[model samples]
Every structure is written in structure tokens, then in C-alpha cells.
Target: MTAEKRIPLHILREITNGFSEHSRIGRGGYGDVYKGVYSGREIAVKLLHVDTVLGHDDRQYINEVGNLLKVKHPNIVQLLGYCYEIQNELIEHNGANRFTRHVYRVLCFEYLQGGSLDKHLREESFAPDWSTRYKIIKGICEGLNFLHSCEPPIFHLDLKPANILLDSSMAPRLADFGLSRLFGGSHTHVTNRVVGTEAYMPPEFIKDAYISHKNDVFSLGLVMIEIIKGSSGYSGYIETDEVGQFTQKVLGNWKNRIKATSEYPLEESHQVQICIDTAMRCVEPDRNNRPNIAEVLDILSKTETHIPKRQMADVFPCPTIGLKSESNMLEIMVAELNNNEHIHCNLMPTDNSNRTVQQLADRETSSDVEQVIIGRTKEKQKILSILSESITEEMVNLPIYGIGGIGKTTLAQLVFNDPKFQDYTRVWVYVSQEFNLNKIGNSIVTQLTDKISNIPTK
Candidate 1:
């Protein structure tokens, strides 16, 4: 599979407002994430730090993009684009000033409105309920299984709460592939340079740099444990015991959770217990003892699995806020799925046949539509001129009226895609026959800025 299109650095800077502090949403090991808008879509841009761009960092960047190019699954974040541009800058070297050109790497990813899994975790007031938590666990396992099942196998060295993002529907999407490595038909790759979040890294990986599919499985196990227990449990769990002891402690907690409430179905409790047991097996000190991701997933699917009916919580945008409302849950779920087509992604087949992988790869990397834009040179220039003359700082509104089947939407798309207005944040709201002001407002707010806006209410 080929990687995402290489975006221009200038366009990135323009969209991100010069990487301003206001645009900054989160920080990673090598860089900061900024929220940006391009082509009427919200995107997350990871700007790698200049100081942290060492030789190894370059390899890590390349590895991440390459591995992401090879995989496509519902739980994995979509790579929208990337930028690798070099520019000359003056700096002091060895107590003297000098000028040198440095390459800056920036990765663009789909912006998840729900933010990271860590955001709604234990400490947050918006912590997900048991059912939502179960869905998240299943999603993570499925995503990890896909990675492990890859031809060469992709190992996500970091699989902590912070690395897992959630879409608008609270579905988990794995992100942050900077620490990933591709295992080329080898059982393990041993090295002295151990790199990963300490809490999530397996013992073997940390001590011996033993890299393999099990490494990610072990990390996923920790993440699962943290999900069931809170992140606060990490300290006590690590301090009190080894993997075996940890497993026993987790099993004890599972038993308590099962016995605590009669409302919790016995079958569901059994499935939860299986998940905990799978996690325990994954964290085994010996790589040979650890269950592979496939095995873990197989064990997780032991219970009766079925499509979950949407609960009452699915009807409201802020269920955690205790807002009283009565509505049909299934209808709400269907409406939501229709409203946001991106979150409707489904799991791909587990088997890594060349045809399957190739088909998936082709769908993502295809530039056919992009190449067929048929840039109407004269029309584009005229529209650009009109927009330049009409737009003002005081929110000037211009309406372009046309009959159905006319290229009105196409013209707007061309304008939005133009490079001249790359600096401005664009939001496209389709207010069809059912014109709801609140919905349009929320949609525009969500598209332009994520930090200041509350979660959108449909």
C-alpha cells in the first residue's frame, strides 16, 4: 500500500494558523497535535519537534507511515496526508552561529470529535458505562488482531489510553504509530534501545528489547486492565506483583464485579472475565507464554456475540449530563449512523490474502477521482475573484442560487479546495429541506474548533 498524499508545509502552516498555541490540542513524544481545517474537513496535524528530529526519529517516522500504508481497519485512525519539507534556518552550533537546512515532518490524521480514550476515562465525569466499555474493549482487540495478522506483522510499541482516540459515536480508533515496527517474517527483533511507554511495555520488551506481535498483545493487555480498573490502579498493580500475581488480582476484581450486581447478566460477566483472563495471558513475562492477539481475540469471542441494540444513552448527545429525554433508541442510532458516515466503518476480514490487502490498499491510495477534477480554469478564477472581492472580516454572506443538478456544489468544492484560502477555516453545512439552526450551528462549531465547543447535539 502507498502512503497518504504529501501535503505542502505552507498549506499546513496556513491551516494550523502558524501552529499557534490556540490550535494546540495535545502533545506527543516527538511533537504537538494541532487542530486544523482543510477542504471543509477537520484534521489533526502532528508537527514533529525540530530538536527531537534525530536520525532514529526519521526512521521511526518512515516506519510509522509505511506501516499505516499497509493496514486499513475500522479501529485504526485514517491518515489524511503528510508533509516532509526542509528549510534553512540560522542556529548556534558548537558555540558558534551557523545556517543549516532541516527537514520537518508533519502527519495529518482524521479528527475524532470525541477526543482520546484517556479523556473520558475513569477520572472524567463522562466515563463510559459498562456496555460502552465492552464495545471499546472489543474494538481494540479487533484492531490489534488486524495489526498482528498483517503479512510481516506490525507491532504497536505503544498501546496506552492516550494513544487510543474515539470518534463521535464513542468508538475507539487506534492512533500514534510513531513507535510501531514491522516484523519481517521474524519471531522477534532484539535490541538494546528499548522504547515505549513504561507502564504498557511488557517485561521482556523493556529488559531485552524483544520485539514481536506479542509485544503489542502484552501492551494491549495492560490497556485492557486499565480500562476495567482505572488508570489509578496502574501504580498499585505494578508495585504489588509480577504478571502472575497481577493476573490473580485482576481475576479477583472480575469476580467481584460479577457478583456485585444482579443487573449484570451472567453471560456478559463471563465474557468480561474471559477478556480479563486473555489480558493476563498476554502479560506473561516469557514471550512464549503470552497469547497472540489472534488467540486473545478468539478467547474474547467465546460468549454469545450479537449486534447490540442501541441503549437509551445513544439518543442523547450528553447522556452523562443527566438530561432527561424520551426517544426511540434504534431510530436515534440509525440517524446517527446516517449523519456521520465516517463512524460507520466496519472490521475487515482477518485473513491477509494478497487480493484482500491489495483491494483495501487500492481503495485508500487511489487518486483517480482527484486526478479527474477537470479544473475549470476560467470558472475557478472567476469564483476566486468574486470570493476575494466579497469576503470581509464581518462575516459577509453570499448566496449562489442554482437549480438542482447544476454544478453549484462542485463550484463550492473547488473554492474550498483552492490554495488561496488555505489559511481560513472552512465549514460546509448541508442544510437541506430540514433546516435546523441548532444543528447547523453545532456542525459549524465542531468543524471550525474542537476545544471551545461542547460535543454536538444532533
Candidate 2:
């Protein structure tokens, strides 16, 4: 099924504005996240960076969304929606005023109040105890196992402490799917461009070696070792044999102590010892020796009884908010803007192959033609951005008008991917010369509803 069209900007402003300062949660390379109430339930909103480059190919975003939509395991992050829109501004280029605006993409998901596992390990005040750490590791393993067990299988290209989020009960959930890949059976190896954070990537991946599910296993092992050592300094090579020797010595002593301690009880001491052993096995230098996700899950399952489960629901109170339909206000605004206008909004039947088009007639005076054209472009972009932030049910359709090769399509693309529009679900289709009304209407309907064929035309 086709994905939903990108949200407009006026809606984005409304969504962001509704998010009070107190609800601001975290910040990252993309943008800031805010805790908000949606439909009387709590949710997390990840605002994408307007200037962030999503690459020329749109498949990256499409792949990530498609992957998330298929997986429904409790350990993985749930994608609620996304936003896309354009923004216009003046930039200084070679001492001249260059008019350009960028398209932004944002995604929304279920909120995890406990923050990331990295935050807990790095912060002294929130450092997880031995028991909590063990449980978190098992939870992550379970998530990886689920991903690896998919029919064609899925691979999380990027796996690190920061990407692992924890719920209110401290249960771990994997987030950030911008770099994930879904594989097919016949495809034994994927040789695409390398994309991921440096430190977390495995040696084979960085060197452009054939990547498989084993690559993710290697990264998971590295994360496991870091958590065990309670050290964030996993980057850079080990300078001296002393560090490795020191670690081995500590494990040896702990093992001997557990064997001798009859008073302390073997069960408690054995749990800690088993965790260390498993971590060592995971970070083996040779990829062939690294355990698969299934084996990791098996090891974790054996120790499950030792770790306690925390109920995430007990931590945060549910918000009592109601969904407000903003369609009327949107219609009114569009009408006012279209007053004495040269564009006509048409309701036509479209299919999954193109966008619904609104034909426009440009009535411009020769003297102020350029000024009028530029001004209208910026206004349209701004309006689209606003619609994205609002997250209303109705589809947002705005057609940019200009002569061929005058950047009309380019401007629409910029508006569709704007970061400010990230909060709503979205998709963009180019309908340049192939404009079938039935196909276009069907495409819009499919995107908004995820159904194929027989879409009702208005």
C-alpha cells in the first residue's frame, strides 16, 4: 500500500505550540523530542532537523517506515506517524541574497519515560544496579531475536547505547530506524552504501564487506561489553594488553570467590558470573564466533527468572486529553487564501501511482511578475508546513503552480520533507507528465488509508 502524504506546516506549528516547555524530553542529532498527550494517551514526538539531509533517494525514509509497520514485537519501537513539509528563508551566498528553503521529516512514537540505557549507565545519579542492568541486557537480546526471526529477516544497521531506550519500568526498547534494512531470502548479502555511526559499526560493515544478520550480532556484542564494564569508552583500540588482562583477572577472581562462598549462596553470585561470561562470548574478535540473536535469547531466557520484571504503566499517569477536529479551521484558512485566486481545487479520482493535482492559472502583471511568483511560493510552503504540525485526519492537498522548469516541482519537494512537518504521517509522489486522475486519486486514498484498489472517488 502507498504511504500517507506529507503533512503541511500550519499543522506543525499547532502541534509544537501545544507541547509546553515542561514536556520537552531529550535532544539528539536529528532534533528535540517532546512528551505530549494525544487522544488522552501519552506519546513521544521526535522533531526532525530542517537542515538534516535525508539524501536524494526517498527510499531511505520509505524503507524505515515500511520496516516499522511490519514489526509488532513488544521490544521494538512503535511508529505512530510522521511529518513532512517545506520552509523558505533567505540565505547568504557569495554576498548575495539566495532564496531557498529546506524540506523536513519528523517521526512520532510511543514514549519511553525511563530514557535510554546510555543515560542510565552514564549518569551517576541514575546508574542502574547489577540486577537492573542484567534485565536490560536480556530485553535488548529479545528485541534483536525478534528482528532476526523475521521471514526475510531485518537488520538494525545501527545498534548502540543511545539507540536503546528504556520504558518507565526500565524495560529496554530499540528505537531509531533511519538506518535499518529489510532483507529477502534470495539476497544473501546487501552491498549498499555504508551508513551508520562510526564507533558502533562492525569492521566488516565499515570496510564494505558483505553484510548479513551477523553484522548486527557483532554490534550487539560490543554494546553488551560496554554495559558490563559500565564504561562508555568503547571507542578506539585497546592501547595495552594490560586493560584486557585486568578485565580477565577480575573475572577470574570473581569466579573463584563464587566457588568458595558457601555463606553468600551460589545462585546470586552465579547470576553475575554468567552475565560476564556471556558478554565475553559476545565480543569475540572473530565474527564467526559471535553468537546469533537466537542463541543470545536462549542464554537470556535461562537467566530470566533471576531478573525481575517492572510494569511500565505504573510509572507515568495517562493524560486526559481529547482529539479536536481542526478540519473546519483548515478549510476556512484555505478558502481565505484562495479568495480571488487563480488556482482551482479539484476533487478527482486518483490511483496509487500519482498525486491529486489542483490546476492553477497564473495572472501576473509583467512589471511585478517575479516578485509575485516568489511570494506565492513561500506562502504555499509556509501553509503546507503548518498543516503538517496539526495532525488532522483529512489529507492536505496544495498544488504549486509555475511554468515548466521554473522549480515548481522542486519547491513542492522542499515543502513535503520539511522537519517542521515530521509529526504527521507522510508520502510524496511526482506527477509530472503522467497524470491519470483515477490513478492519482487512488494513490492518495491508498496512502491515507493503506488500502489497495476500489477507492471511492469524490
lDDT score at residue 271, model 1, on the 0-100 scale: 67
Error of 1 at 127 (Å): 4.8
Per-residue lDDT of candidate 1, residues 1-458 (tens digit) = 24338889999999999999999999877689999998899999999886424587777677777777777899999888888777888989999998887889888889999888776775654543455677788899888888878878888788888899998877898998877788775658987775778888777776777777877887887788788764534631343246557656765665565566424456556666677677667767777888877777777665534322223111111112122231333234335445664331122222222221111111232223334444344555776776676554333444555445444555556666565764554546666677655555545444433323333354
How many pairs collide in each candidate, listed in order?
0, 50
Q: Write the per-residue lDDT of candidate 2 for residues 1-458, one digit (tens) a residue.
A: 13553444455445657445766787765467777665565667776556634464345556666777777877888877666666677888899998786776666788777778787777754533455666678888888888888876888867889889988877799987776778886534657666667786666667765677777877787787777666675774343455567467645654564456423334535666566666656655566787888987777667644322221111121232222333443344345434525323332322322333322222111223333333234445565555545444444444444445444543454555454443433445435476554454444434444444343333
Alpha-carbon lDDT, every model: 0.67, 0.61
Clashing pairs in 1: none
lDDT of 1 at 33: 94
Q: What is the lDDT of residue 187 in candidate 1?
A: 54
The TM-score between candidate 1 and the true structure equals: 0.61
Instruction: State every prediction's TM-score relative to the real structure.
Output: 0.61, 0.56
